[model samples]
Structures are given as structure tokens and as C-alpha cells.
Target: MIHEHEWQQWQQQSANHAATAAFLLLDVQTNLTMLETLQAALDKIRANPAAEPYSLSGNSYFIQLQPHRVLIEELYGDDYAEPVTLSLDDFGDALAYWHTQI
Candidate 1:
């Protein structure tokens, strides 16, 4: 279940961008509880990776790199068995930089 604060945020964003998809960017190591909450939230909306249209839920996904192993999972949509992982420490900054260029 989504918390009251998160629900309100989702509602506000949905209302503000009716035609655009909302994405949830979170730090995987911020907190264990928060990570679990995010995982549950994403699981609720996850889609089959093999389905047509190949869409994700709410435009949210997770990326993690540990040692030589890179893990990628669609937090709210379809995901492939293997995820494309890159070397990056600050996910938010990378996303923001990409957004500016795009």
C-alpha cells in the first residue's frame, strides 16, 4: 500500500502531467525499509517483459551494480533477464544530465 504522502504525490503528478508518464527515481541504498516499499510498489505494476508494446509501469525502474555483477529489474514493468548496466555512482546526476541534453 502506498503511504499517504506518496499517494498524494502520485495524484498530483498524474494530474499535472496527464499525457506524460511519471517516473520514480530512488536511491537503492537510502534505507532498507524504503527499498522494500519501492520494490513492493513496483511489483504491483510490473508488466511482462515479453509482451507487446514492451511498456513499463509508471516509467520507473531500478539499476544496481555490485562488483562484476550488474542487476537490472523493471520495478513497474517488463524487464529482460539481463539488464544493461553502466558504471555510474550518482544516478540522479546522470539522469539529470541526460534530461538536459535530451
Candidate 2:
């Protein structure tokens, strides 16, 4: 359930040849602040799957918090279409690692 993805390198910059986006996976890591926020959001969703699906907005990402997963319609450097189902335990593992990272 740790979703794996490959980024498409567009040699030709053209919208006509654009590819459908892939949804966000739980393992990506970067800015510490954002990572913490995402982890918190994940915790909330897992704690109360019944309270969703709601939205979390920021300068770059816009996530749809579902029962057990998040839909990243506008991740800064990613493209997403169908929602990616997640394995919470794996995601938590990533988050744990993220703590020791930036």
C-alpha cells in the first residue's frame, strides 16, 4: 500500500501532449513544515474517517481528506487523476522517517 510512482519527463512542452496526472503518494518528503502538516492531517483523517471528505489548502497543495486517503489535485510538482488508496501504516512509517529528515 506504499504507492510507488514514476514522474513523467515531458521532453516536449505542449499541453496538447499532456499526460493525465497521478495522485499523491504518502512517501514523498521535502519541506519540514509541509511534511508535518500533512502528517497531522493524515492523523485527523484516520482518527475520524467519518468527518470527511474535506479540503486542506495551501500555497502549493490542495488536498481532499477522505476517510483513509488524500487526493492531491494540485501538488506543486505532480499530476494526479484517480484518487490513490493508501496504506496508513506505511504512511505513518514515512512520517516517522520524515521527522529525522528536513
Candidate 3:
């Protein structure tokens, strides 16, 4: 499980991108395959070009994807939150990092 400090540190890291954040969070929270989450995020973006920064919310986290970047936000209580933004390349790096972790 991810601790609060680790989550906060991730948000501060300039290297952490959208795909990395999504995969890490999902891996901890569910048994779904990583490809499933990646495909879902891509599908959401392709299905709604107008929603450039489209978002998907899970029980405790949310991810917003844009053409060149992505944002991952972790929700706490009713209003508290932590968010991180990443470029496409950084996001790819993040995905690779998580894959290794698994």
C-alpha cells in the first residue's frame, strides 16, 4: 500500500507523469491489468476530442488526460487533494517504472 508521504513525494517529483501515476494507483487498488487502464484512458481521450483534459475518477483517485500531458489527483476526505502533472515522455517513463515494480 502507498503511504501518504510517498504519495505526497510523488506529487512533488517532476518526473512522475500521468501514466505512471495512474498505473501505480490502480495497481495498489485493484487487480485489473495495466493494459486495461491504459486502454481505458486512451479510449476516453479518443472518444471525446473536445474533452482535451478528460478525467476518470476511481474510488480515491482521478486522472485527467490531455493531448500532450496528464494530471493525476488523489482525493482525501471530502475536499483534500494532491495532484501532479506530467509530459507525455515522462508519462511513458512512469509507465515503464511501474512495469518494473510489478
Best by TM-score: 3
Whole-model lDDT, candidate 3? 0.57
Q: Rate the local accuracy (lDDT) of all candidates.
A: 0.34, 0.48, 0.57
Candidate 3 stretches with Cα past 4 Å from truth are 1-32, 39-54
1-102 per-residue lDDT for model 3 (tens digits):
334446546545653443356546654334337445654665566567565566666665666778767777766467655676676555545544454455
lDDT by residue for model 1 (1-102), tens: 334444445334432221111233333323445444434433332333232222233324444433322234445545343344432222222333324332
Model 3, residue pairs in steric clash: none
As for candidate 2, its clashing pairs are: 21-79, 21-80, 22-79, 22-80
Compare candidates 1 and 2 on lDDT and give the better one.
Answer: 2
* Candidate closest to the true structure, highest lDDT: 3
RMSD of each: 14.6, 8.3, 6.6
Which of the two candidates, 1 or 3, achieves a greater lDDT against the reference?
3
Error of 3 at 76 (Å): 1.9
